[model samples]
Target: MLKALSLFTGIGGLDFGFEAAGFTTIAAVEANTTVAATIRLNRKWDVLETNLDPRRAVDICSSTIIKDAGPLDIVIAGPPCQPFSKAAYWREDGASGLDDPRSRTLNAFLQVIALTRPKAFLLENVPGFAARGHSGGLDRVLTGITRVNSTFGSRYRVHWAKLNSADYGVPQIRERVFLVGAEDGRDFIFPNPTHRNASGTDDDVRLPLYTTCWDAIGDIPSSSDDSLRMKGKWAGLLPSIPEGENYLWHTNRGGGMPLFGWRTRYWTFLLKLAKDRPSWTIQSQSGSASGPFHWSNRRLSATELFRLQTFPQNVKCDASRSEMQRMVGNAVPSLLAEVLACEIKKQFFGAKLDTSKSPTLAVPKSETAPRRTAVRPVPPAFHELVGTHADHPGTGLGPGAAAGARAKRDALRKFKAA
Candidate 1:
């Protein structure tokens, strides 16, 4: 298995996904004590607890963690994305990019690179990082990774892509940026999105089963206002509907009126579209922002929020409801992680035999071994997710057109070199 080190490891979402994909994360560096504690309790893995802001790059990458992580084959991190997200205030204020302290996380992540000299690394962030005028920061990251690899005698090249989690079989249509860097000059290809779990269902559009609001967590009991675990249906007055079922917990319902309504009804127009079509982007909102979920109703529950992030049923996520919601909204889904890891393995190890697939490290029978859970496959109907190009401020992606993003990235690289 590839030896991995995870930074900014939030409750192990990236760590768990990586492990599930067959990479072993020997060490994770996280600043939150409560969240870090939750990860250790659930996974029993080593954690480096430090609250020093990530911009303090050199300190975090200090030799101690590098030693503990030991011979890191891969490094993975999802830096905080709020200040750089499109939804953030002042984003349209001609704000020069990378002024925010949080934006320097990649610099710190690279500091570790200069020290540890890992063979490969992955950086995950919100799509806004690729937005126009923001390319300066992106270029810094691209050039830094490339130059570091070059100097270390390891090749560094990146395949930067923005992917929709819903298209990859997750229940919600959350989009994020994934930048893969490989040292060996091996072409790093992004994984194919396997499932389209979100789609327009209410429409008479004759596609098979693209996933719907009713599919992923439809089996859970109708949300009750009293239950922190459950919130009343999104449309309180609409006909209660059956979505799907989980491990016999309760009957999941769909399409209920939400708490936020002007006419005692959620925006029926948007609701109708979401019922059958894949949702717009599940955004990285600070809760101070208004459009991440894009419904004029009660917010989605933590578990439901986690569902959109494609987290498995058994893995526990501990956070305040709002914290959980934001966490899921910001994370890189583990399914995507699995896809990327497999690709890296093919490039690095070759067919001589895959280290990721080999179970050479026998699990020591211990009282506290992390329980393995079976992965649920992306449903076939998930690919039916449908959407039109639309962008409303603070909600959804920028018109669903990737037309010039690649070109911009290229031009950005040349600009940086100049």
Candidate 2:
């Protein structure tokens, strides 16, 4: 079996996937005490608690931990992505694009490549890491990797791409950027997308339909009785919002309360699942107020969230509800990781990409049909509650009415908080 080393390993998501692809994890580094403990509880591998600091390049190079292990065939890492994340960028005290302190994590990752000189490396990060604002940081990371490869005379070939986990049969639409580098100068092409958007016009019959939210966790027992249910105004409002819609659906334009206008609120505010569609991205920092509520108007259970992330049901995570939520949300979907690992195995280890052991779900033939024609009608009770009249224009609060818009916006915030 090929030997692998993992960095920033969060609950061993990538480690498990690569192991499933026939690689053995020799060691892993994770700084979070709780996450590292969880990894130890579930996996039999050496775990490191130190942060990957490029400044400690010499000590890391000659570290006893890696020296005790044999040669490494591959190194995989999913560095902290907060510095370049879109969510962070929008935060009040967020990083300044390329200059964030967290950006050093990528440099430390490169320093590992320089020190260990593995046959290949796989780097995973948020899609926003490659965004225009952070392109310089990305370029620096690539340059650093190239420099290391050149110094070692490895002549590594690198390929990078943005991939959506939903296209690999994960029930959530999580997009990430992956950078794969091979030391032997072999060209590395990304794996072909095995699933297509179920509701789109893509006519590629070779690809399967995208996995739906129902396909992932429909059978999981409802968490409504669990202590995770929504409270306060959300309890009253969510049940009335249509499936696959959010607070925007309750706007006056949609024949509901005139608290806010369309597109004024966050996409996940009051979001509910659509039984027929894939889920929106599972957020790492989800809370009671940050919703992607079940169609039943309740929060999803830990197991349900795990299923959406494509983690095996048997995989135990010994952590609290909130910690588990962060771990699952931040994890690379095992299916997507497996696909990438298979490609790496084929390229570096001369191994065939195995599909027989992969999980398979039965998709109905009808689900493959285009979803454009499926229109959900407004419930009659909702229309009555919102005081909708047939002759009235659909416009809720008229545009260009600044004073009315501001009042409605304030009301929306109050309603959301309540």
Candidate 3:
């Protein structure tokens, strides 16, 4: 197993993705009480929790991680981005890279990366990395990493790329920046998205844009199944489901009491099916009655969100409703993680990790699908998923070789966390 470590480990999303990809995280560092509990409950691995902020360099350089898992194979994390978030203060100060308290967390994450001296590392953050404000700060962070690498006589090639979650065949259209690093001159490539988008190739039969939201999750039941019942803490009252089998058949809705700092509003988008398109972005909370979630007036359940995010039927989250919702909202879809994992296996391991083991959207996680004890069959492709993005070469299959099999399976898992 590729021994790894996670920093700024919010609800263990990156940890989950890397693990699914085949790496074993030796330690996870998180500071939020609720998030800590979520990580502890979900992860069987060791997790170190502290509400203490990371502004203090001393505290970060000497944490429990060093005391436990000495030096790792890789270090990964997404430092908090709200301060630099476009949705927050970044847009106002002429995009002067707001000093987000959350951004400071990155200082600690980087410190850990240096200490661990992992062979490879990945730093994930918002799209702000492209802007002047964030770019300026990130430039320093990058330089610092390189400077340290030089001192250690260690060679690292660092590259940054903006990846769209949907570009990889995930149902949602989320996008993010992945800052990838590797030892010396080792070649590490991101996965080629196998799903096509709004733009299509010459073949009309192949999928263009996305397979609709309904197509992504048409197999699961809207209700009446015990597995779909709510398990997390309710952020607000569950929106009343109008008698209907699908979100496409939605109706008018309303508002009521508030939960947390957010008030209740009929989230019309979650329940209403898009016009022959995919549904809105799935959130972490299962019961938020925000728009897109509330169709006509009914709220989308946690199970439905799980499906949209592309989680297997058997994988279940154990946090309270609100906590689970927040965790899911912030998670990197499992399928997306799987794709990243494939890159490691293919590019880093070179034929060691089999890409053919997983399927795409067409196969829901099932007993019929491959399992720990069963012989696995080839996974199917979604009928709507045809040609890949013009940019993606479609898994680079060789003569008489397997094509797109693993891409689809990874995409299915990513949709849920992404």
Top TM-score: which candidate number? 2
Query: Each prediction's Cα lDDT score?
Result: 0.56, 0.75, 0.56
Clashes of each: 32, 0, 34
Q: Summing lDDT over every window of 10 consecutive residues in candidate 2, give the lowest-scoring window.
A: 360-369
Instruction: Note the residue pairs that clash in candidate 2.
Output: none
TM-score of every model versus the real structure: 0.67, 0.83, 0.67
- The alpha-carbon deviation from the true structure for residue 409 of candidate 3, after best TM-score superposition, in angstroms, is 50
RMSD, model 2, all Cα superposed?
A: 7.8
Per-residue lDDT tens digits of candidate 3, residues 198-317?
A: 655666336435544555555555565443343332312233322211222222212211111111122332344443345556554344334344232334566666656665455466
Per-residue accuracy of model 1 over 1-418 as CA lDDT, tens digit each: 6888888888666776777667888877888776787677678667878743535556666647567656778888887877666535233332234756666777777777777778888888777778776665578788887778777777777779888766555445567788887777677778655453324445524423344554544454556554332233222311121212111111112222221222221122222113333444454443322223322234456666555555655667666666655555666766566656667766665624353442221111113212222223323342232222222333322322232344445556887999
lDDT of 2 by residue, 151-251 (tens): 88877777899999888777778899998988888889998787888565657676877888877776666564767778754466676677787877767
Tell me the deviation in Å of residue 352 in model 3. 3.0
Tell me the TM-score of model 1: 0.67
Model 1 scores a C-alpha lDDT of: 0.56
